[model samples]
Target chain A: MNTVIDTILAHRSVRNFEDRALTREQIETIVRSAQAASTSSFVQAYSIIGVTDQKKKEQLAEVAFNQDYVVNNGHLFVFCADLYRHEIIGEMESVDVLPSIESTEKFMVATIDAALAAQNASIAAESMGLGICYIGGIRNDLTKVSEILGTPNRVIPLFGLVVGYPAKINDKKPRIPLEHIYHENEYNSEHESNVQELQSYNEVVQKYYLERTNGKRSDTWTSQIAKMLEKQSRMYMKGFVEEKGMNKR
Target chain B: MNTVIDTILAHRSVRNFEDRALTREQIETIVRSAQAASTSSFVQAYSIIGVTDQKKKEQLAEVAFNQDYVVNNGHLFVFCADLYRHEIIGEMESVDVLPSIESTEKFMVATIDAALAAQNASIAAESMGLGICYIGGIRNDLTKVSEILGTPNRVIPLFGLVVGYPAKINDKKPRIPLEHIYHENEYNSEHESNVQELQSYNEVVQKYYLERTNGKRSDTWTSQIAKMLEKQSRMYMKGFVEEKGMNKR
Candidate 1:
């Protein structure tokens, strides 16, 4: 009911952005807001690449599988889980930093740090009456993205944020009921398989797609997920992340 | 510069908490804000378990290597990157979901989703005049934490959040220079190894620790990270996530 919660719940990833560019002030506020997010152990292990050059945007859009919004949004910011800075700092101090960089825990920490910053940026943009979309599809080609951004080893582009004024608004998608996604004191699965939760949500999603796409696809949530997961998708991310020298174990 | 940015930049993880509990309304508002965070697709692939019982908190604190905030906070919420609900939904519809569950991309997505949610929760709590801390140490013994929480397969506790009134305030830690974190156009490492940026931050961190701890530790960020990383920390998370039936590859 609070303004913060209201902002959080009313979120819908906006793809169609107004043609007008965001003012310099807005971008500064957004990025500064991003910096304000809490970092694990104050390591601040993340970086963001702001892309406005049309050609660079086009390349990134293609890298994100031609997600046009990457090219057309008010701005595109690629968030990277970066430990490279830590390495640089260590090198300046003539100290070792790899043991922290190579482990899964630190990798997850950096990943989460980037994510927290991205969300803060998203919320900040939205607070100013802007629309935004998270471009996870950016990971569709990590190497190309790193190449485009001049990212070195020990940095991985976790995801991108496309911020803009809303040209179109998508309907709010239904989330699972609280009972299914929440537990009281311990991990409770008694209701995980409950038909009441599953069947009802399926119906909601079925109607969502039907109405949203003008009946182009009439499928339930379960069916959609099953279809998406039936075949291996993005299986190369492991080796790709390893190639980037992240979480190499 | 706005209220949102101010709230974010002012964020300090408070582990020393006043001995008071969050009201039902407060918890509801905070959790709802968490639920509102963006997810990869509409998967909503995350869950939160709030631990209130003294015994349960004690057990979890021990699991987190005796992080007393887990037991002392107004509330403790364990944020889990959960695919188990998707699995259950898949089962109700008679389909396979492991392929998606086991991939690095999906694993990263779920982890990011939980992090996004947790940060929102943290911000919401802060906005409500509360303090919060993220407990990544929950992963120190993921299996034991899951056991305490009764977590099923495909659901891993990403981290814990301790929310309460601040009993103590830590001085703000200085982050790296904004230029270092915000790159323009491409992945420009042109200044990544700049000793100028490195030395200034080292002094800032060196002074921060020295002043905060009454000169108990006069270490710089580089030296601290170097010392911390020189030895292995949390080497068990990879195997732990795998044991939880996530990212099996």
Candidate 2:
């Protein structure tokens, strides 16, 4: 198999990192690759905040509920779904951008673009022998993250990417079967895998977590989903997004 | 630089593709790499629809406002932000998934997951000497597209990706200067690039489109944003997303 495919397929989230630092050249090249990702309509509605300040990273770690990767990684990249820049560009060119920027479609466009670019960054880091972790925990407190990042209105810190040389690699987790994730021309929920395939996969997942933690964790995939979804999590995200002038039209 | 980095930096949207068919092995490998992308909380909240039926591609092309690439490529893979499988899994396990599935944060999570997977698919295809074009025009009329694809609630067709051997490669467009896109430690709007960097990049982009089209197009970067953001394009997307039972608290 090719190296790119190898890098992609073998990805595992790395939270542990060595104390060594990444060279500036590597950092520049990685972000350059992120900029090279395909953006919708060339809107390029995204930005990256490179966090190397130890104090700031520590604060962010707290904001992410003590996810130490926010502070312990070689670098932290805050990927922003930014419509603020589009507005500035429009103002620079003497046009109103809000007719679109303030709408849900554009918000999603920006979010999706930010995500695509961040994935490119992750892949780029992996190709360079670096390990990466996507830090969605930052969304637990968007207000604190925004204040820390100085993000203005119309800018949402969608997620963070922590990149470094791996100190430890967790056992790879199994995904749901392909037949359950891929369809032909139409949405197919009637597939046997969709309705009846969870039991086997749940066993796989249960064994994975069980073995990963020396049998300390005994829950299956279904139980985890049940616990996580039993109550509203991150309901404030919708409010935060709307407060950013998105979805307000 | 490595081949992976080279392939990434040389990305350009390819609309014209050589009329060719991809092998089953190649298709399987590409989707496998897509599944390798990280999903939030192991939700795996995404699905891919591979459109091989010529007539179906034609109708999707119409849905995407006659983007010929949607029909003219070697493969059209519809990346969907889907939570239906999670619900089924919940049902199979006899747990409630609606409390979280009905929230907006989950929708964004699924959308981000699908986009990450699609980008990986794009990268894997590119590494294999294939071309790709991300067709966001699928959202221009998602309601009809849903009917065409039989997409049920909680399954949004985020975008379509066309992969093939390129018949013609457009000149790669220049991105905004890195200083504009990447912030250090905090958001830096005072940087010279933020307010004053577009002119030079505009020149680069203008020259690119001008030469690529043989002087047929002369618009600058700012002008394109001004034009695209002048009106509310895809305004119906908000309603469609809500109707799909996403983004509703």
Which tens-of-lDDT digit does each residue in B83-129 have in candidate 2? 88777766766777786897878988999999999999999999999
Deviation (Å) of B240 in candidate 1: 1.5
Error (Å) of candidate 1 at residue A66 is 1.4
Shift of residue B111 alpha carbon in model 2, Å:
0.8
Considering chain A alone, what is the TM-score of candidate 2? 0.95
Report the Cα RMSD per candidate: 2.0, 1.7
Error of 2 at A183 (Å): 0.8
DockQ per candidate, 2 decimals: 0.66, 0.73
TM-score of the first chain of model 1 = 0.94
The CAPRI-style docking tier of model 2 reads: medium
Model 1 spans with C-alpha error above 4 angstroms:
A210-217, B190-192, B213-216
Residue by residue across B22-95, what tens digits does model 1's lDDT show? 99888878888888888887778899998888998998898887988889989999999988877776676676
> Any runs in candidate 2 off by more than 4 Å, and if so which?
A191-193, B191-193, B214-216
